[model samples]
Target: MIGYVTIGVSDMARAKAFYSDLLADLDARVLMDLDRIAFFGQSMGKPMLAVCTPYDKQPNHPGNGNMVAINPGSKELVDKLYHKAIELGATCDGEPGQRIPDRFYGAYIRDLDGNKVAFFHFG
Candidate 1:
């Protein structure tokens, strides 16, 4: 089972603010805030996402092929959050649409730190 995923960030303040505004649509908030890391989710019982400086103190770099996916529960929400991410400065990786006919609809983007994220609804 997944508890959380952490993305390495270059700027803590910017990362926090960006996620705060973006995830607010999903009702996620800062569940935990530490000096080097902050977690966001509606609650600890659900899977959470976090952003932090590298523990080794090295520069943060996004991993190739790594991504975090959020299921917003419907096609409209997938579109909504995708646009919201773009409005918050995320670059589009894929436009919101049905990725699999009659099955999955989704959108993808790279955040300010270049971490890949997906907004999807699966039926």
Candidate 2:
């Protein structure tokens, strides 16, 4: 298994803003702010996501089609992440609600790098 997912972004400030709001489900307990990276983790586990400051790529270009789906644990956490992402200027993909297609009762929000990160409850 890997240690963390370092997602590249153009601006650390913008990445911090989006992720700060996105990861607010766990509050500052999980997201530890640093110089160029926004580190996020689950309680009692290793660092889960690292929104890294971009180097050479365009502002919103994501190099991967893969997305990091966050297991929010409940409907409330899913709602929190969805709303917060929009509140922090993230573009909404799948709104804060349920989806019958993928069995994903979740929301999808694209971050600064245009990476679709899903917040799911799976129930």
Candidate 3:
């Protein structure tokens, strides 16, 4: 239905750092870069996540302000990614588990700038 989701960020450097590690943890690649950054996954068909600088001017900001979800290859990888995001300075919003009633197993995390990111594995 779509190609990529580009979100706003305050600092490009910080945003790059945050997403670089987060994407690598998912075994994703830095496919391209422009006014926005694009991250590619191992699976060729997966949609890339694009991040850009925020245009709006605001005194106070909120967490992540947005959400970008990625899928881990396995349940173990999901757990690893969930904990790793925290180790890398990301705040864990939700721990890796069944998000719904036996539905989604995922971990919701916020990046350095407070942007929400998630990792999941149905298995």
Candidate 4:
């Protein structure tokens, strides 16, 4: 099982700010803060999401098909989080909409460091 997910970032400060604002809507706050990484989540039991500089001391790169999916609690919250990510400079990968009528709704975006993130809700 996945305990947490980490995304590499070139600029720690920028990534921190981007996630700080974006995750606020989900009630995810800083759980751990270190010079090279920061973790965010609503609780320790929930999977944490982190941003960090590469441990290899090389330039950070996003994985081509990897992504972190976040549940924002409701269809409306999915829309809000997706838009908020855009407002914080994240690029849109998909607009908020139903993936399956009355079953799944979601949206996707690339974070400041170009890592894919999704916001979704199930009915």
Candidate whose lDDT is highest? 1
TM-score versus the correct structure, for each prediction: 0.97, 0.76, 0.77, 0.95
Question: Order of candidates by TM-score, top first?
Answer: 1, 4, 3, 2
Off by over 4 Å in 1: none
Q: What 10-residue stretch in candidate 1 is worst by lDDT?
A: 97-106
Q: Ten consecutive residues with minimal summed lDDT in candidate 4? A: 21-30
lDDT over C-alpha atoms for residue 86 of model 2 = 82
Output the number of the TM-score-best candidate.
1
* Candidate 2 segments whose C-alpha is farther than 4 A from its true place: 28-34, 42-44, 55-60, 101-103
**Candidates 3 and 4: which is better by lDDT?**
4
Alpha-carbon RMSD to native, per candidate: 0.7, 3.0, 3.1, 1.0
Clashes of each: 0, 0, 4, 0
lDDT of each: 0.95, 0.73, 0.71, 0.92
Residue 109, candidate 2: Cα error in Å is 0.8
Residue 83 C-alpha lDDT in model 2: 84
